[model samples]
Target: MFRVLIAVGLLAWTGLSRTATGADATDAQGEVDSARRDALLSQAQDCELRNDYADAERLLRKAAKFPADERVSAEILVRRGDCFMKRGKEHRAYELYKKAIEQYSLYIPFEGVVERLRAVAERFASGEASWFGVKERDMAIEIYELIIAKASSAKQAPADTLRLAQLQTEGDQKLEAVQTYRDLMKRYPKAPEVPEARLDLARLLLDLAKGGDGDGALARQAQHELDLYLQAFPDHSRRAEAETWEAVANERQANALYRLGEFYLRPSHSSVGAARRYLHDVVREYPSAMSADLAKITLARLDQKGIQEPEEAGQPQAAPVAAGVGHAAVVPPPIRPPDKDLTPEKAAPPRPAKTLQAADQVEKWLLPLEDLSEDTGEKAK
Candidate 1:
């Protein structure tokens, strides 16, 4: 009786296990329906490309019914957005585009999305298509920010970060480009892209300095980065260019100092001594540079105005001490009359001064006969 009961319990357990396994398999199949939905969505996108908006919408609606994965869902949203845009429903299309971007951001292969967005931006920039404009480019930047946010965890972060910084530079968002380059350096110090990123960051900072919005600190940061690039990659293919950029960075810094000196030269706030020191620094530190030349001219002008050179200007004469109640004031002895023996020497007669008239006669005597005749006629008159 005991053996029979054990056999009956085993049979019941086996049946229950098989039932649970079948349910799990069914749930898994339901979850994996995304593959089928993705295929349908691809087909719908094809139809939409052919201007078949009605069929595209129908297929998209069907695809949306499945439990699609994030990638497929993002693609579907983008396709639906495109479909709406084709139907002249811009507001709806914008909404879907935004949703698609948000969904695409969560996917692992975010770099691929970045590539597509870059292509779109390039196409729009080249005038090849009007469908993707500044709005799409801006979305691409947003996506790049997301990728950079995950840089510490992503293997391809450095490359994507570099591309994003390049895009920022191309977009003329220089400050953003600088920050992105700095981020790349911090996150991937040993990355191969670091040298070029440093170069670019330095270049952008130099550009900011040229734009007249830069301060001493900004110029110094640029110079430091350029110096680091040169030291880090002495044999790089763009080493010469990098060196040139370094020179530019130095000039920018020197220029900042030169401008500060100029500001101090104003009569309302005259700091001639300070101005002379700054200008002298430009000449000493960057001798042949353009700013140095300007500094030289400025220094010369200051000198003409009787503003002493930096060396002499820095040394002030000692001030006279005033007489005080506690100190005795000493007075010098009165001058005695000159002694006759000290004034006894007599001088010889002085030579006569040469006048212009006498010099002209001398010149006439030294001239040749042809010139002498004219001189003689004038002299006779």
Candidate 2:
């Protein structure tokens, strides 16, 4: 019985020692994890202060791998979002911001997020953050879009929307900018920026009309917008500029009509009278316009006799020569007979018989009579 009790006591002591050892190991691991998280957070903060967003993001991600308390995780997300914002990754930053907001909604305030977004916009607007290039500008635009979308009041909404529209214009999103400006006018007509918005919208419409393939409808619309601006703000500072644009729109409309007339005149099936009427209308309605000058010249050309249609016009007529002058005649060289005997197949010396006869004739003419008689006697014998 004594041995049995001693064995049971030893077993209990062994079990207790094993449990203690496991607990101690777990505690050490927890401490190491905590220290690692703290170190990562510190390094990330330093990188952010130095404006090294890439490294800051790297460290923040590493820190995020370890288990963190709710407050700590929320702070980490906010910091990561800021890093993304500074790096011109606004879309990603916005996602992080949303995540941080969700995490911090119960315990922490989100006013800081609003302030941060506004600060970024101000930096971009003031040219303090060098948001000139396409990438940075686009990112800024996205950030402002998010902020504007979340604007709480009428006063905040108009300014943010106006800034967004301006940024869109700078980024070559003309169509979007036009829509934004129109929306601002419709929604906040009495806003401080309404006047500027009206001016910009009119200008954008004119620009769209001036494009080579622009719609005639757009040109007419732009002219109407300019008229409204002039009527509403006669004493406005930009009234003269607005008037100039209105004239430009008028010129564009007249030019469009002139082009259409030219098109009608070009096709074989179209009527010349229709083209003439169109051109005449332009000359009458917009006499001071540049297209009016072109229309007059075209009308004069059309009025000339025997040039009623493009087909009859044929290629452009050569300029008339002087009365007495004509084209210098291009006289061809006279034809010559072919030399058959000098051809490669007939390439031989003069006839042998003729040659021999010529030689004998020369000899008879030049030789003495005695030598000739002696040569003849020898031949007879």
Candidate 3:
């Protein structure tokens, strides 16, 4: 009786187990359908990579029929957003991106959705249409703010910031662009774009300096950033160009100082001494440059204007500084060499002194003879 009861219990358990297995099989079939949808979503992503939007749309539409698959649906939405963006459908792309993000929020983390949305915004910002597309600028700024808000978990926040900064530059908001670049460098110190941003900021600052800002503040900032770029990207291909610009900046600063000196020394009667000092500074500081040459010329002119430097007390009073005003000592005309063939004939040999004496003596003797003859004629008469 005990063995038969055990057997009966085992049989009942087996039958129940079979029924549960059947249920599991049915559930697994549903899962298989979901898997197929997910696989198709993956294929759609591949099509996007291949730039085959038609096939990608077809696959995504099929994946949408599997309403039970949330992950697949989110992926399809993202891909559809990409397709719309590529096709120049900004409003639709923006809408699709928002939808995708919303769908991803259901299960996928917000961080993942943020990156995709940021990318979508970048596509708009980078395209030529951005110049006229008000929505793109707004969305880009929004994305940047979003990244900043979630910076702690944002993997590509720096990249987003850089794109935003570049867009600002394109929009001609140089000050905002400079600040953004600075912020990016500070926030993402090791980002690859940091060097590029530094270079750009330096250029902008140099331009500011050229615009006549006082205190040399802009130039100082530019020099600092230039140093950063050189230190960071020493072997960059554009290194030569950067160096050239640095040299140009230094020259411009020197020129500005020299011009200030000239302004002071103008007819309005500012201190000539101060003007000379400024030029002297340029010559002393930038000896090998064109600015130094200009400074030297200015210094010479200043000296000629009776500008004097104190000398040792005992030293014989140095010649008074020339008051050049307008006149430069006329340089004498160059002497021409006597043409060998055209030179006057060698002077006739100086008559010998003895010969000259003999001629004088002959004249004396002839005069006496003539007088004697005149006396003789008188006696004969």
Candidate 4:
């Protein structure tokens, strides 16, 4: 019994000693981790204050190397990436953000790592730039392209395509932008972006029309796109803009048609039939639109010969008039000019207007006008 008691005591003492040693080891590790973390944080803060992003990044990398908790390690990687970005090392920053995403993916409880990744992605989307002159425009395009390619093989977000289209438009890559928008309509017909895309597309088309693309073609295109936009997003935030653009496009098309009709009576009538077709379209299809109202006024002017036809065939008729004669004949309409209320000084914007407004937009375009038939008795009403 004495021997058995001695053995039991020895075993208990050994067990207790082992437990103490284990606790000491754990406490030592905790202290080391805490010290390392504190040192890294201090170094980073110092580097940032001194504007030494390189040193800050180096310290962050060392902190990431420590076999600390996974959370701490991931956080260090993110901090390192942020420092890299601050230093204009976008490629390096992207790599670190990618690393953080991967590491967090392994232990994080979120549905996917996209939210964390998106934190960085949003900077690109919001148009941030790196010190290296790498703008978010480039990154956003790359990400959008990647998402589009991926969606083909997986459940890609429709929002990705929309973002790409928006970036392209903002970057002045119009044809590609429109194509991508069309792709969104085809691929994710039900996506929320589809309606917004349509609205944006319509506005772009109207701009094209006013910029002097074929008025007939542009008017048709704008009307079609605007109809689609209105159908899809009648109450969208930009609905008023869409409506206004739609009206402007139609008005332009009508003016083109009326001008063409007047040209038909000219001795040098070139494209008279085309002008009539345009006028007919304005009167028939856009009956309730401002263009139609202008069309009615034009038809009456032509009928009254307030715009007399150019003498035909040199047969004892009046001498040929100048090209602007027709335009001069018609009384200026009552439409309010955009800046009519402002004085010259007040009308001047901080910068010269690089873009055209609804009223003055047609000045730059060169679309063909239709010839008028000298006898259509329509009124402005």
Q: Which candidate gets the maximum TM-score versus the true structure?
A: 3
* Model 3: residues with Cα > 4 Å off, grouped in runs: 1-83, 99-106, 109-119, 126-155, 308-381
lDDT of 2 by residue, 179-282 (tens): 99988888888887776787778778777766653446677767777887888888888888888888888898888778767866764435565577678878
Native-referenced Cα lDDT, model 1: 0.70
Q: Give the alpha-carbon lDDT of every model.
A: 0.70, 0.75, 0.70, 0.66
What local lDDT score does residue 371 receive in model 1, on the 0 to 100 scale?
Answer: 53
User: Could you list the CA RMSD of all candidates, in the order they appear?
Assistant: 26.7, 16.5, 24.3, 27.5
Q: Pick the candidate with the highest lDDT.
A: 2
Runs with alpha carbons beyond 4 Å of true place in candidate 4: 1-56, 59-91, 98-127, 130-136, 147-156, 233-238, 270-280, 288-290, 306-381
Clashing pairs in 2: none
- Per-residue lDDT tens digits of candidate 1, residues 196-263? 89888887877777657434566677778878888888899899998788777777767866886787
lDDT string for model 4 (195-292, tens) is 78787777766665666764257567777888888787768888888888777876766666566555554555433333444456568866877767
Worst 10 residues of 2 by lDDT: 324-333
TM-score of each: 0.55, 0.53, 0.56, 0.52
Whole-model lDDT for model 4 versus the true structure? 0.66
lDDT of 2: 0.75
